[model samples]
Target: MKGMDVCFSGLLTRAKHLADAGENRSDLAFSLQESAFSMLVEVAERAMAHCDKKELLLGGGVACSKILQEKCRIMCEERGAQMFVPANEFLVDNAAMIAWQGVLEKRKANKNYDEWQPNPQWRTDEVKVDWR
Candidate 1:
């Protein structure tokens, strides 16, 4: 929930309030790490409400967490949506992957080859290396 706008902790506090008001419900989800369970659940639920539940894909570094994966599975099942998570290699980061992505985007941008100096701290918006 680091970048998430919704506060799960606040939701938990509201759930506690509901419990105090005699509406004892235990449907809760949480993660101590930067996992995508909450976002996946939210997206799945929203999609299920509109379309057929068969087109949700979750793939990233956060997708491998046990709590996240299992919770996403349960949320998808409950919402009648399908959740797809690829293997761990697809989730983890590697420099080869970075180079591959750079090559692909470079090709699409019609970038011409030139002497490119690598920066240790390159921000996408800051650097405008027009190879073409």
Candidate 2:
């Protein structure tokens, strides 16, 4: 949720309200964590179904969270899919993945490369796929 603007702000506001109401901090924190993990699992499962995938791989720093790993494990089990997580040492921040995206975009560039710029809102189909 770090880069997720709306959800991150909403979660912080909720946490503040709960704290002001004298809710047990540990319980409040776990509840928030669980909610976030559950949302991630729900979305992952949807993607798995959409792609007819039988394996789920949890990557990046968030995969180091034991709670999230457990939730994803249970979800994968219920779907009769396998879930895989790399060792904690490999779950470092996503800088490598981010950089690899630059490599990919470079491969997609051509004579019109000057038109290149990151466009988060751009449609996937809008990309020329000759690089494939």
Candidate 3:
């Protein structure tokens, strides 16, 4: 489908091949992590540049990775940007961020908010955020 999906599929195929070849699992995992995180950092750098943003805020479970954090910090430093990462406790999937996002959504919602139904499969780009 999308270019990213294809790239990810290729990565998975490569990882599977490595495993099937009886490669050391730890080494394979490390290689995969490095490749994935490098790609992520590249994409983040592009996005920051495209948006003319000087601040990088990382969240979610992946943000908890020390390697990823370091990569982000390096990118930020190179770009003279500020990187903000929550404490480890808040880096992973936690209810506090969800609650805070809900609070923000509720505040932005109009009178039609009650009619909005939660779609478990909702995609970030699919929703039309009129609340903004």
lDDT of 3: 0.80
- TM-scores for every candidate against the unseen true structure: 0.41, 0.64, 0.65
Tens-digit lDDT track of model 1 for 42-80: 665666676665556767676777777787788778766
* Model 1: how far residue 14 lies from native, Å: 16
Clashing pairs for model 3 are: none
When superposed on Cα atoms, how far off is each prediction in RMSD? 11.4, 7.1, 7.2
Runs of candidate 3 exceeding 4 Å displacement: 1-7, 94-132
Scored by lDDT, the top model is 3
At residue 118, give the lDDT of candidate 3.
73
lDDT of 2 by residue, 1-132 (tens): 322211444676789899999989999888888777777888888889989999999998989999899999999999999999999998899788768866776776743557767565554456565656
Q: Give the worst 10-residue stretch by lDDT in candidate 1.
A: 27-36
Put down candidate 3 lDDT per residue, 50-130, tens digits, no spaces: 899999999888899889999999999999999999897877776786787777777787436677687644555676765
Whole-model alpha-carbon lDDT for candidate 1? 0.62
The candidate 2 region of ten consecutive residues with least summed lDDT is: 1-10
lDDT by candidate, in order shown: 0.62, 0.79, 0.80
